[model samples]
Target: MRRKVYTKDQILKAAYEVVENEGFSGFTARNIAKKMGISTQPIYLEFKNMSDLKNALLDEICNHLYYDIFPEVRTGDTIIDLGLSYVYFAKEQSNLYNALYVQEYGGGKKMHDFSYNYFHQLIVKHPKYSKLSENKINALHVGTWIVVTGIATLMSSGIIEPTQDEIVHLIDRTINTVLQEDDTSVLDSL
Candidate 1:
């Protein structure tokens, strides 16, 4: 049968949509091609293998999450709102969230490391944290992983029955206690 040709962008987009709607386990060249109304050959021509396709998808998800959501999270902003937004994001984009945030689709240890580095850099950039030594920055990396991951995990798992406001407060109090700082909008000044 003759097949339609899809661009690299189209295939990657279809792959992401498939993962979001069908979950990571549902991801495959066949399904993606079906969604794109094209053939697997196009994907093969664009990518070395499925891992390459997934890695591309992961990179795209990382870019979207970091630029659209993570940067918008102001430390000086309402902790409740931040927590609410996080939960909302998870629920709203469950499939992407599960794939990028939860699912072990393609060995996401590097993704985790990237997240850890991101927060650590943010902390280092903050005037409050700038005074801290290298050890302090390292400590913040560990601290952020423990706290933020815990919050994200809780919301993503849907096991904790907490309201947005309550979750915000919980997250705020936890971060505040650890940082020993009252300000929430740490990103604005920088």
Candidate 2:
């Protein structure tokens, strides 16, 4: 008997549903197959193994993370708005955000590089940053990422239950600190 073929996208859609409903803990080949309404063998036929399917899911997640959030980073806009949007995206897609960054997965390359490169590029685009050293820009990027990630984890773990207003204010402080520091420098040096 010929094996039935499933499209790669079909498997990804099913996998996303599995992630949404069951999370990483509850998803498995059986679950996906049930969701797809087909035998698991078709998944095996389409993908070499569960890892292949998962890597594809990660790719889609990466795309969603980048595409959905990139508009805020682009537009040559103010950095403060960009920082706030980051938190908003994290809050809105908490599940997908945790899945992309918090979950353990096989392909280390995609896990580490795909999302980060865009983040690095975004930091380089900051308007006030052109006058700063590369090290300073890199530090700002890393620090901003740390702030958002820490807040997301804290919110998810229930460690720091910040109101939405508090989160907005905190993000505003982080972004405002950059210019405040720049503006507060010794004016006599100019």
Candidate 3:
């Protein structure tokens, strides 16, 4: 019998499946090998080490979020749509969401940077937010991100099952509160 060789991409896909199904805790070379029905030698041969494989997996997860998850939301408003996509991802891919957000797994900064930059771009382009200073826009993004993340965490853990309408209401209220606070801060400063 001849030995089967796995490409890096194949190994990465197996690793992703392991994490998606079993969360980060199951992200081991042995587990990946088991999933692929091969020995761990293939994984070690394709990647330098588990850390390297995990970093690659993080990129894979980010790509999945960017392509598979984020693009599915289209509510005519980019910012709100992003929030909805996040919540939807949490609900649909709870294990992946927890691995990235709750467990960190070296993905927290990547997710934060991606979300903040994306939100900033949308806010800068929005008619309502375009006039706001960059500082104010950043504040608004952070504030809204906190609320959205909290809701997503709760939803992913099955602690709270809010309807889409409820999520929209909560997100809208958070955005409004942030803007209102910024306005009041300006008034107080005046």
Candidate 4:
């Protein structure tokens, strides 16, 4: 019998699907083999180790988050839209969210740092935040992300069922409080 062959893309795609359905713990060579109907030897041949495969899967997940998920969250406001999108992402993809943020399965940048970096980049891109200093922007991101993550966790855990409007109001209040002084001193206390 001829040995089965699997492309790198096929293996990575299978791995992503396994993780998407089974969370971070589900991403294993055996699972990918089962998903793709191939032997684990093909997976091993395609990837040096599980870590390598995980990095590839992380890239795929980031792409999904940035391209597929982020675009759908819009409210004519960058900050609000991103916040809503984050919460919605948690609700919709709780397993992936927990794996990326809570479990740190990607093993590279933590979601907290990623969120901070994302918020900074987002702030820089918008004219409204052009005048703000880096520290102030960092403060604002931390403050607002706290609220966003809290709402996401609650919703994802099924502990609470807040509507989108209520979430928007909470985010607005958090942003206002963080930016009210328009100074970096608030960041010191945080």
Backbone collision count in every prediction? Answer: 5, 0, 0, 0
Clashing pairs in 1: 75-184, 75-185, 76-184, 76-185, 76-186
On residues 44-149, what C-alpha lDDT tens digit does candidate 2 reach at each position? 8888998878877887877776777655633344444455565566566666656666777432457557645765566566655556655455455555656777
Q: For residues 1-190, what per-residue lDDT tens digits would candidate 4 score against the true structure? A: 9965788889988887787678778878888899988779988898899988888777776777667776564676678888999999999988777777766564336456656767787889889887887777878887887788899988989999998899889988887877776564655477
TM-score of each: 0.76, 0.72, 0.85, 0.88
lDDT of 1 by residue, 132-180 (tens): 5555455544544455556666666776666556666666665565466
Which number leads on lDDT? Answer: 3
lDDT of 2: 0.65
Segments in model 1 whose C-alpha atoms lie over 4 Å from true places = 1-4, 73-85, 180-190
Off-target runs (Cα >4 Å) in candidate 3 are 104-106, 183-190
Reference-based TM-score, model 2: 0.72
The reply for model 2, stretches above 4 Å from the true place, is: 1-5, 73-79, 105-112, 156-169, 175-190
Worst 10 residues of 4 by lDDT: 102-111
The sequence of per-residue lDDT tens digits that candidate 3 reaches over residues 1-115 is: 9978799999999988988888788989999999999999989998999999988888777777777777565666667788999988888888888877778453678777877
lDDT scores in order: 0.66, 0.65, 0.80, 0.79
Distance (Å) between predicted and true CA of 85, model 3? 0.7
